[model samples]
Target: MTKVFIIKFSIFILFSFILSTVSAFAQVDVEKMAKNFNIYLAFPEKHFQLKDGKYSGGTSPQDFANVSIEKIVIKDLNGDGLDDAVLVTVGNYGGSGGFYELTALLSTSSGLVQTNSIVLGDRINIKKIQVHSPEAHSPPELGLIKQNFEILIYMLKHKPNDPACCPTEPTMECFTIHKNKLIPCKEAPEPPVVKKPALYLYPIKNQEVEVEINPKGKVLKTIPEYREKWKVYVTKNGKINGKYNYLFYETTLNAPIPEYQRGWVVSHKELSRWFDVTLTKFGLNKREIRDFKAYWLNELPQFPYYEIRPLDTQFVEENLTIKINPKPATVIRVILHFKGTDTPSKLEEPAIITNVRKGFTAVEWGGILENSPNSDIKPQAKYSFLAQDTGVVVLRAIDLREHKLSIKLSSNGCTDKKALKSIVKKLEGINSQVPHYEITLIREKPDRCKALISEGTTIVYDLKEEFGINTKLPYTVTVKNPIYPLITDEPYFQFFPKKELKPKPVEEDMSLKEHLIKATVRAIEMEIKRYETSQQRDKEDKIDRLRNEIEKFNKMKPEDYILGYPNGAESSMEMFTYGPLMPPIHRQVEAIIEEPLKIGSILKLTTMTKSGPFYHIAGINENIDIAKELKQGRYRMKLYLVYKREYFGFIQNYYVYIAEVEKQ
Candidate 1:
């Protein structure tokens, strides 16, 4: 059994983003509803009116018009991601019984629309009536609940043979809007859990870590490709040794949300000490605590006091199927939540229980700390990365000309090196009614630039040159990555070539050139993993820490196999860079080695912008020095060559980088 410990750390309440979502209740004439309103309920089958919140018609004790908006709160009721209104109204007809109804007013783009009305039992006394939890979170606390709207209604119902005025049997009921009607939420096994729970990973020994979870709902978003189940090596310092030092992946799962009442209540001033003592007890190391604080320190709300509650660890262990491999001996996971209040809430201190960190221990800490109105943190302005999600990469609108193929695709500014040679599988051709070919867009190298292009860039692939596809005929081009077709509708045109195609058909044997390109692309991708790496928290200190980590990593023992080193490059490769040999013609010419070449391979070189060649491959490396022919002021060039190595029986290749030369 995995001895896991989870903590919910609530630092302070701060609103994530200030959204202008005015509630429908604000527009609703609730005062008018309490005054003269029509009540359609079980007891009062006919229309009954309540003028000024009361109607006592002396025609009979049963003829009474008692209509009042008992509880009016604002929340989303129709899953439209907007604030709606829910009201509990009382009606007095048939003297002995009092009719209580649940009414929903859904908010629309134009105005509020009254949707459904439900009746609670007659002659029941409402104990507590509210929309949110004890925390009293506003409608801005969206994304927590998904499909349904919930309201807490606690009341006392009459028992058998009890007095008409007062007969009490207290009961609490939770009601959610279903299919535009309010119903008791008893069918669902558990209440929904909070979204974005960051599960940090800290392993004692340096080992590849992979966590797989089976959430009731889908895993909405998780960084570092959790869906792929990529094995990430985590160092003792809790850093995922990679280009980006991602420690853990947070997920939004559907499970029972754990609630904790027993915790410490403190003001913002007492936070530092609170973190040191409480997190220490929770078995978090100094480094982990620092990371936790750094992420939330600036966003901390400056309320008079706060209620810190850790979500129950049991809820995490059972509901969330978190399977860690090479199973951890000890695990500590904490999610802190802070509720800011006007006054200090006296809370009972819950006993913290966690096992000592043994071999292969794992520690995860994250929380959902919402902000109050008096929060110190102000909402930041939104800049538009504003591009629609690629969902990997969306490919559509394919127009194929004679030699060149124009494709409309999703891009992130640096998509020029998105792919070199693509694998085109002619699954169904000439024989089938709708000719189909599955084209796999292989991104030979990742676009390192962080430019967010609003409109995606276009990809113009030379059918005879790039992917080696012949576009003389028409055939529907289906991108196999997402099974999306190029030119989805009528007039689908794409020709799959026979001899020129680098990736041969799945059924046919691969040509020597196709086999080599496939092997080299894989090799280049593998080498790209170790490029430019750093880890930092979310504050000013994070910069310093990342700098320190990079320096430390660079200075590690040579035997440790330092990060950012070329794959399989044990000392053979040198920084392929040079300047002018003669003095009068002071030229600084440079060439980026696209790939390493074998002994007899051609030494090709081209201008940095790839407009024209500075010194193109005229002869093999063994025959001539390509640099000698360059006549330039200061030229940047690109060298295209193959770095092939025989791995026992299989062939492997690698890319030579520019950064590797800087160190030399």
Candidate 2:
């Protein structure tokens, strides 16, 4: 009986455990969830509020308010089986008005993530909030509304005319997660259409009148029209109710026009007085009316005076002078017109000149001139002037009298003689030397390699078949200065091929070769690092020594070294080669030819590896005769190999020669 009781109690405990686990996973704290999502609640603390239900000593009553979290709902979103939270919040200022907002939080593995927060309306009341989760289909998708759940919020949007007790109507809005953002489910309504007043132009006998008409075609009012043919001015009074907003030209017979006074209206109706009109009451679009106004007011007045002034008949002399009177600090542009094919010998290109002080400005003209050295102006050329201030000009181009003159000139960059000369000199002195060499090692066939050599250049040598040995090895050759130590400590010989070769190891010998190759590469890396560090240290030490010597020299009296023989003069003078060092078999070395090669300097060429020396040739004489012989034909120099190894063992006891041949 006791055993049965124990079994039954254990079963009850297991059942309770399972139920607790499920509850723990399903339960979510709404407040904590909202805070985790960074939900924007219209809480009273963010704005003005009343303190302690009364005004504080210095705090404003309207500036403080009471805020509260209204409602929160949690449901599975995106069919992920994880509950997401939505928050509704409201804030009430001391008065009757308040604010409403909605926030959404997505449930993530780490925590609740805030998706979106949007303000619904100011002084609004939220009536209802509901989460609509539809039934899942064969395949579930995540979005704002198509497949995922959405939150519908019913609210009363406060209007300006709404009474304090209640808003006029209820507004419905839906929101959901879209691209990680909370957006409205419905698009915003379109704007209301606005009606504009129609403008009409009427021709009444000799006068033209402009009138404003409503959409029904009834005349509203007639606008004032300018009637003068010559000397017409436009004046803009402020905007009028239902009147067309355009510039209206006004005719003033005796009054002078002001300078640079823009913003005036010039209408087609006012211009129709000077020009003939074909329509009585025409309905025109804004752009068409603007074009018609510009044509009559700005362009049509100049048509009657299109005649080009005759050259020989008007001007008897070669030169002419024009005097213009413009207001102070104003620019006057003068243009010239030429008659007949007789081009002017010398004419100052038309330009706008500013007059700093009020007085008569003199402009001289050399009759009908060419625009350029190769181009000439046409015979019937016309000129016009656009002046800022009211002024009269007397132009005497030989003896022609005209009120206005137009000249066109081309603008381009001016040439600088000094800059051009400097460029020409540089072009004439460019270097044309490109030194290159090709060497062919004679064997069963021929192993040939060609290269362009310069200071600090590196060359790679493929010596797999040299001396009739077909061993795979990596090699690099560099031109070096003999005086300087070798740039690298890695051996010129490698027992194994490079990593990119992908050599197969089927037998014991093949496996051994692969292992040796890896070992050689590792050794090469370490040696390269060691050599680079050593070179950097050497350069730093040399720089320090030079700095110290400079300091010592600066402190010394001029007579110390300049007046007497320097210390260790004889000991420091050592015989050295000035030409480039012979490059290593498989390494990079800088060619340090300190000065240009002298005719008789001896160059020592040596090739060695970290293991030991492989080849050394001393006392190579540099002479004009040898250079001439090399330039004419190829000459092979014998290489003496020493301390030969497995990879390079075939070359041992064999005469290896290389030629320094230049291409024709």
Candidate 3:
């Protein structure tokens, strides 16, 4: 996890604490100001009446803010000899900007009272504050001289055309007390726009939704301290207070959202208009849409154009694991993942799903702004998985033999051994006697079509040869959350030798060629029967032609096929489940491969366990065994075509399961 933190007031805080403690030792006007002091900002002045140098209050909860005196300098102002206090106060609301103000606490017969202050703008840096009183001076036109002392404020201000984040210009302000109010002798600079990935939650109507969110990344900041969840009585306007309103948090997204394969390529000038149209299409209200734009536009890096896309909303909601009580009737989460580009990119458009705000609705809008395809921002990998591109695999059966750990993963018929990847690392031990190791298996590539043996796919990791583990000793491995206790000392669990664990059949078993032909015919017939009921008429010719091809195999005798595995041998294809044969997901891609390849080239075969694409395959190790059975002659073997899908909505995540070498 790479964390970038800007310590905004580190020095100011330390100095404030020291000054506060020193002032506490002796009763002074500063102490009086720290307690119950009055602040006059505008006419009919609103009294802050601060306590303990800190105050929290506003017109309402929606505009609620927290204010603290960050730094203070003691000096005699008004030429009154009694020491007056110059204070820098910081106030932060529910959102990004922090309001910094320059104020004074003057000593009078009535005690310390806060005078009229000046808005120093957001994120203004104060270098020093000095009180300058000449031996003789004349009053100017603007009602001068009741609390007549000049104040010199040296600070850093943002220059014109500067991004709200970095204010590099050095400037100073001169002020004088006029009728007890601090009047700025110069004009104030515009506030700098602060930015980060801000995700806001809206539950329109009297806190109708109680939300609990486990984000895919670490939270940088959250108002009201996000402890598990937030339950705020939000107003219909989505504003509860000036300082606090709807729940919000900030996090850095490490990469582009994987589900976004298509979106618009827009120029810098088009960002505002693009956000309006796209956000409206994705179901954001007027207020939500406006807020999203306001938060990023000021600091958006200038680019010729940008490639912007959105993650599947359902994917975001589920992956973020948003839980709401009195559940929202509709949940709409929009995140614009964008990268700066040189020009408009030609790409496919994604389908947009619009939502309506009814009853109790939950709306969330955020964005990931990446200046380039590859930036140095390395966010924490707090997410479970990056994307759902891996093939159909749902279960794992693990074993360890010869200091090697083998994981047999459940695959649909398309699962191939080459498509999978695994990594192993020896972890620091939790127990002195038991060695601990961690392993993860990811299907980097998915099987689309291949000769599938019914047994599941097996991937191996050599602990002794690769990671230097003792072969004779027992060890423990962590896979996901489970600690697999591998009792390698017992040789009984090692099943990789293709053990003949099958029962003897009463009749002669079918040959390899006959088995393939029967399953193919049955599957093809089932597929043809399915499309027969569809309204489309063009597929009629394909159905008829496929039916004619299946009948030829049905008419052939099983004894005529010379390629036969020993009856009940482990090398023979078997059903992972029994019943009717399952067909391919796409009838158009159903194929057969027999390009003069030797049996030695056949490394893995997965049997079709479930119906097309939600593929679960039964696997067995027969690569070496099958190779030996076909030796002495260069023979060509036929393979089956199958598909598997996780069936996630709008995301098929299709993969071609190939052979130990087939799909090329």
Candidate 4:
């Protein structure tokens, strides 16, 4: 067996270590604020009671509904420096009818605390929701737009008492908790109507804009933008049966909710209105309609994310701007939250890595490795890498003065333990290999086998060829001593004939026709034997393999053959024969010339193997000339024998032409 060694050693050894540190970078602490604003974990059902008072506490096992967090946005409700969270859930719930909730959870050192339970929509309903709110921002505000965000809230028919129970016109409203009391805004205005404002609604700035070409000129995908905020209010003249109670509220005690004024209905209609205006007004296409069906804490299925009829939409942009808020604390709070179902809590679901550094950037500075000096490496016990839709392995490099290191984190593909260790050791060794040198080796071949040679790069090789009739040859390469191991994941090298193995090399030529005929005869013998011995065999498939192999040999020049064996027999001009083989041929037969040629044409040839005549091209040999020789009738052409068997073998010889054709 012929073996080839691939040397993938990088000489530039980067002296670095996978510094292990505590899990300090995973969270950003927003110090505790005023009293009475204590954070608690709500178990989705049973009113969100005080922490450890009656209902499940925050992040407790019982409260977690097994699910993944898709979206997490933070906003301040009382201007307290501390951020509150809105956790959006995704991934496997208890199948159909199982709720897909996106509750607004209050974030704290205590963990995610559910404030309001909102359902996104189901597979069927989600489509409709998309039509209603293609880019659903939690709360709709005319501001800068970013990602395609949509929100849909479906409420149950109000079941209240004393005239304020049913409304003539059912609309969305916001409920607030004050001094441990549920207060519904009675004076909340019906969903507002603003004729899709004529402000610039497209062309998001500072982001990659892909322009795909159709029959029309270049067109960009439309990306709708909006805000996630609301205005809260309280009114005594609350509408009952969609009409104000004339007797009770004759006076106007109109005032916005004190602390809750900014928190209002992140409505479904507003979402729908926005979708219509942006998608239709601009131009963006919807490829997927994801439905999210959310259930109440009681597991009562309600609110669907996308449930609008015929929700498919598309768009094109004009000009858009990203409203950069100088103070994210004022407009946005980066917090972590997870979405979940009522039954199986999604508390433990790994939070998706969002609005943070990409994995590539993080992997640098030892973030991707299992163990480092700067951090503790914990195996994500519950979720497999495949199940992780998104996750973050944060790393912070703080000098002695605690100044954050500005190094970029690059994601590397070394997930396995062995691979990761190799990388770490290789990098650690760089400092000694080459004190102050950097080298990069680029592969010359098509494959990814580039060599990065630097003073610090460590490499080892054993390029010796083995000799034996039937032997398992092994070619090994080990690179050490550099600060970092060469990151050559793949490499390739040309196989050259060993000098000692061949006493003397002689060049010879062979004819195409003669090669093809001899290969066919050999193939016929192999097929017949296989057919007689095998319990179940097809004669046609075998014949096909035979023919393909012969054609392959005819196309190749003998000199380029990897097999260094001399031609089996030499045939002279006086009498030449390749010898016949005994056979009731069973192999399928067909022939193909690599290059169709005229009389005076030159063609390169090679041979391959397969089970059937319709075999795929595998290997190739040298080149041959079909032109008439200077001495007429003296044909000098190379030929190769082709066979369809367990192993590939070849024979070579030169041929003489009996006749020649004149040039046209």
Query: Candidates sorted by TM-score, descending order?
Result: 1, 3, 2, 4
- Is candidate 1 or 4 superior in TM-score? 1
What lDDT would each prediction earn against the true structure? 0.48, 0.31, 0.52, 0.24
Task: Write model 2 residue lDDT over 268-365, tens digit each, in one string.
Answer: 23445422221111223334345444532332231212212212312212122111111112212212221222222222222222324222211111
lDDT of 3 at 409: 57
True lDDT of residue 14, candidate 3 = 85
lDDT of 4 by residue, 54-163 (tens): 12232421222334443444444323334554443432211111233444444456754445454433221111111012123434432312111222333332222212
| Leading candidate by lDDT | 3
Q: Estimated TM-score per prediction?
A: 0.33, 0.23, 0.27, 0.16
Model 3: residue 518 alpha-carbon error in angstroms: 76
- Angstrom error of the Cα, residue 657, model 2: value is 99
Better of 1 and 4 by lDDT: 1
Candidate 3 residue-wise lDDT, 70-116, digit = tens = 67777777776667888777765433345568888787887786776
**For residues 8-127, could you state the per-residue lDDT of candidate 1 as single tens digits?**
222111221222223334434544453455444443434445576555553422233456667666665555676676767777532223567776666667655565466776567877
Q: Candidate 4: TM-score? A: 0.16
TM-score winner between candidates 3 and 4: 3
Pick the TM-score winner.
1
